[model samples]
Target: MDFDYDLFVIGGGSGGVRAARIAAAEGKAKVALAEESRMGGTCVIRGCVPKKLMVFASEYPGLVDEAAAYGWEASAGAFDWPRFRGHLATELDRLEQVYRRNLERAGVTIFDQRATLADPHTVRLADGTARTAKHILIAAGGRPVRPSMPNAHLGMVSDDIFAMPSLPKSILIVGGGYIACEFACILNGLGVEVTQYYRGAQILRGFDDEARGLIAEMMRAQGIDLHLGTNLVEMAPAEGHPERQPTEFDAAMGMPASDSDAAGHAAPAAPRGAPSGPIWVKATNGSERVFDAVLFATGRAPNTPGLGLEDLGVRLGRNGQVVVDAYSQSSVPSIFAVGDVTDRINLTPVAIREGHAFADTIFGGRKTAVDHDLVPSAVFTQPELGTIGLTEEQAREAHRIEVYCTSFRPMRTAFIDRPERVLFKLIVEADTRRVLGCHIVAPGAGELIQMIGVAVKMGATKEDLDRTVAVHPTISEELVTMRTPVRTA
Candidate 1:
């Protein structure tokens, strides 16, 4: 039986939605999308959106403390976890409705049930309803990977933690990635005791060494129990892993990477600038701690399970991410995979671009592939870290890189009486003079790094950076005015 539509999309997340909407609006194709959960997908429902809101809620905790240091004497502050949770609920509700309206407007028939490929072109719903299309796409995205501590099932991943019924008094995060650092800052800032446990030398392993150092110093000062060079041996009903229960509990993860190869296979290398280990971690240091709650910011795995990729012989990387060519297609031509599922560039915007490129190739007759280089990333930790292009470590390995690094207190911090300083670094190629990377750890590095990203992406050179007029009275001006290189090989 031939399918009804010209295009069918699975996993209605950022990538899925864009592909569906674009294919429908511009092409002569009918489209339908299937997702078990709400249409908003991971970024909107659990990943970015909710995580950021929680971050926003947590930021206030520092302000409350800063008030006192600035000579404003105020009463003790209290955190209303319930109130904060309520605000998140309201916002989630609004976003869900918006997603449905957008889909309806785009003429996408959304199936609110689990979808799997019964065959190459046929997708089956939970109710046994079947739909076939000329082309099929998988955009199921990824999920958090829990740590391998004994009885670690009790801990929460980035996804499940948001749905936690009650906020724990203290959180012990096990990992040294972006999520690990972000949560440490968030929980600590919100007045919840946070102890970060990482089994590596530094918290952010692959990030610029200086940025990682600055973050470590600030987090320790902010009261986060920074544990480096240790890991959890086990987890029990109690904080100390005592009070053994006779009843059986499912372990979230099977074993340590060294013990069981992380669930029957070696784990993939974490993100670039990531410490030498997995992601969900923002950095590294081999260590351990105990707390009221243990959360895994270890990393995420691609969502390729039950999507029928195995049955169809779709190629996969060692980490189980679907293997695709530069054009984002599976081994089977009519079947396409994108986003975290492909693990090419697992970012919301990156996924969106893949979707557009896929749709363009299929519908608009445009031949294009998403580029991984010159990609920019930001970690939402306090004094957030943002960077684009090469890190000094990566540049040193890839090219004869030159580095220009600086550290200065932010203007606001200068008067605020805190000793923390904003740190920045620039990496450039020694030969071509092209700017290879830019990094900043500061108040609004997320915003400031964008312009530098534009500069580095366009093959900006040392001379280009030197000749550009500095915008006075701004932190960003430091990029253009940086006259000397700190290190060169």
Candidate 2:
């Protein structure tokens, strides 16, 4: 059947853009991509790029102090949010332009508007234009969701961080995930009094317990008011409000509070003259505090709402993510989905890989499927966390594993008199000696893990790691030099 284009891709995120560009350029298929927002999607525009830059900016204060200990007179001044934000804005603008230009150069038409499925093979744009295609791909990605609590409207999400008018004098961050911990460190480094409330006993859930625990310790040492086993009771505008009200539970909910319940609380009516001001929050720990801003990194939901996917009989999971097969093909023969919208390995690199594999399979006739295992990921906190392969918990449940772990102050921190310690851990199969996991907690952990990831992905055994000569005096040398298993089971 004749169609407006060979392929119509909805949502110009990393996955959608890659699919559209590849289908058009390589497959010589007619492609049109409709994006409601900017071209680069979450990772490029808001998530990874900007967040990493903020991570870099946040580290300067500590570096200045360390320089002083190294006999260099150095001190950090107040961070200029206006100036740094302006440069960040320019960098984002430049990146968006690059995304648009690349799509255009690849002979793909770009629609700078939201597009949703009208049918298995039809997409309707926001401007009342319906376009038909032989095939459609969904890559709408995800968005940060605000907690549905009383006066939660006063709180901000990850997206709101870049657009903040100014860095708050103090911030109350809610959540135990990477986003919460990352911004807590970032804001604290930027000289804000940052308080973090994670109902979970520890942050960075699903990671190495030892690594995350060390990170929690480091964060506390760095002056983050981290409250474990704590949840919010109620909140209101700090200014022009009544005196503090006692919370119902002196010791509120336990650790790992149900986020859905907390996020769904409706805000009470605000008093008159309650213009924008600080927020007052009562916690599960029976404490009340006023914070200049409340940032909720509680969670992110798939951007599948109102996209017309469900209406067209596209299968959706409980979380509203599109359900797809190994090849990213939807239940509908003519439709497919990838990236965060599919809820399969929601990292940006994974999305790109899925998108590329989908295009190659469908258009290029390569019939490729993305390898979902052992994808490297990092949390860009003050001292970053990088990991690949299985966690020790997963390894132990599945195999007879030997664990090698070490923690010590590095040479750089040695001179600074900082108590900060670095963690290097490995989980290997006891039988085959295959390295099952690699996790690190230190500066540059992210960069270090990328190389380690290659080894782990290659099915490198512990012997292979042992045979490689250690790079002397480097933190990563421990990966090769550690000869004895600390624990085996």
Candidate 3:
């Protein structure tokens, strides 16, 4: 069949770019990609890249303290948000250009506009042009969702963080997921008075219970006013004159005078005559406080709406994620979807692999399928968490398991009298002795677990780990040296 292009990709995210490039360069298929925003999608422009930079910035205060404790003269000063933000913006711009250059070099046509599926093999762009393709790929990715409530638009989501003009003096972070907790830590480190309200009993739901518990405890210890079993009852912008003076804590910390009349207040309150800006939140625990900002890190949903897939008889899941077969093929043979838009292991690397596999299978005749199992992931908290494979809870339910776990203050923290602790855990099947999972909670756990993930993916047994020689004075050595079973089930 004659078509405008051999392949048309509906997004410019990691998945879409990879698929478009591979199909054009390696498979020699004519490819066209459309992106409404910056060339690099979530991971590059907003999600992982910017967030990790914030993580590094947040770590400096602690690193300075640790340095002082180690007999080196070190200290951290106030963070200059404007300066750092400018640099970050430049880096993102450079990265976006790199994505553009890569696509151009691969001989893929770029459409800097939104494209939606007009039919199984047809795409309509925002410019009122329709094009037909032999194959269509949807990698439109997901977006953060704010709560459904009155004035919810007044709050910020993860996407808004990069664009905020200035850091808030105080912020109320809502939710318990990694996004919420991570921002709580980041803002707190950056000198914002942070208060987090989570409806759940603990943060980082779906992770190891013990590891997440320790994280919650550590967050509290680090001065995040974390409130669990609590949620927002109602919220409104702070309006009218101050009924009471700003507390001594506020005054000492340089917050605007709470008692000052609307005309004379120095702190930026919600505009005096308007019902916008400073927020008054009433939480479920019978507490009402006004914060400079409220950040909703509640959740994200698939970016499948308005793509015209539903009208074309393409199946979608409950979350509006495109339902696809193992080969990333939609119900219609010529259509496919991958990455967060598919809601399967929504990591950037995973998306890249899925896109590559799709290109190989359909264009290169390589017949590849992405291995979704045993993919390693890291959460960039103050003490990062690196995990791969099943949790202890999941392992126990599937088969008899032996758990090896240890938690202790690392040597560096011990020297500084810091209360920080690291945890190492291994979940093994009792019958076969194969390591079912490895989870680490420590400063560099993310890097360590990447190495451990390779072994676990190769089906390495606990005995294999034990046989590896331990490196002296290293926290990761604990992974190999733990011989006794902490628990058996």
Candidate 4:
């Protein structure tokens, strides 16, 4: 509600918006923020929010099956693509309005324009309008990346899947990252034939090996095809018949165009809540399968391209993320950075923490720094994986940590007729007895890991956990009751 702002945020993402408002409220600095797209950054607008929606959408199919097991007759469900997509859009529209209202209520000027850093002190808007501020913040976030290929233009990335031109009946997904796995889980659970290709020996390369193996096993049982240590060689349409040939990585899967040979094969139908067209996929493995659609969950990169940071001499990481100091300060002291742009700890809550910490240290006169260690997070894949502090391997090397690992079927599986089991592992330092690592694979892993994360953060010992009164008949109770070490230091 004023003239030139004291702080002009270049991107109105989670970090930027929070920073601007906090700085103004307490810094007494008039603040204004600009957003090129919908606010809430990646997590709210494109990344986590929409991805979780797809997860819930996918889970309904499993729920239907379970309902029948509970003596309720349930048939194969039907999916109305446009209706589901429309509902998601409607909710997001409401969310966007809420974000705008929150910013306005906080007394921060919200500008709907793309922003570019003119210098450390000045920013230029998309429409050539200019704003000056004593302090400038860059939190532009990231963009989805694609590999160079013949049919990349026709394929989809994580950001594109939510608003697909059509749902894929069968999909060949490339890459082994969480993005790829999450999408595969969503599509496969929704009844789409899914084939995942990873260049590495295992998917979720950074997670515990057992969890990865079990996930692969479970997905295979559920009918999701897995191809590890693979890459795409070529992509070409099937000639006169559909079988297997060479084609783009995105289009691999299905009966190739000519494999079906001028006949459309009645267009393979998908189960309920699934897309219709078979996704074509080409993997690095020199195998080609034709599908009606292709999705590449390659990964994400900082969305700093349009916002000119290089010209300002603001140092960037090898991945193009803005490099910041311990205090989240960029090369320019008056200008700071936070969130995904920093690329240190790319999580929603981490961004919020960094934003608040920066405001506290700078305006409130308190010292703060983000600790990359002890940053607990979860990946919401099928049989979710959650971890905090060091992994077993990391702890073993860092502190001579002895890993105490266990695998067992859950009580629910014993009674509910589900075959999936749970795995829990703990890493405790031999010298200090302090628990350093935790890995879990099962329902509520995300929720359960948070408590262990607090324990590790507070320097809890193995004995402390063992002595704590554990609630009985719970999977987490197992975490506190392991007697023998799976491996010693």
Q: Which one is best on lDDT?
A: 3
Q: Model 3 scores what on Cα lDDT?
A: 0.88
Using Cα atoms with residue i matched to residue i, what is each candidate's TM-score against the true structure? 0.88, 0.93, 0.93, 0.89
RMSD of 3: 5.3
Better of 3 and 4 by lDDT: 3
Candidate 2 Cα lDDT to native:
0.87
Candidate 3 has a TM-score of 0.93
Which runs in model 4 stand beyond 4 Å of their true positions?
Answer: 1-3, 236-281
What C-alpha lDDT values do all the predictions have? 0.77, 0.87, 0.88, 0.75
Output the better candidate (2/3) by lDDT. Answer: 3
What does candidate 1's lDDT look like per residue over 104-183, in tens digits? 78788888898888888888888998988889999888888766544445556777656554555666788898989988
Which is superior by TM-score, 2 or 4? 2
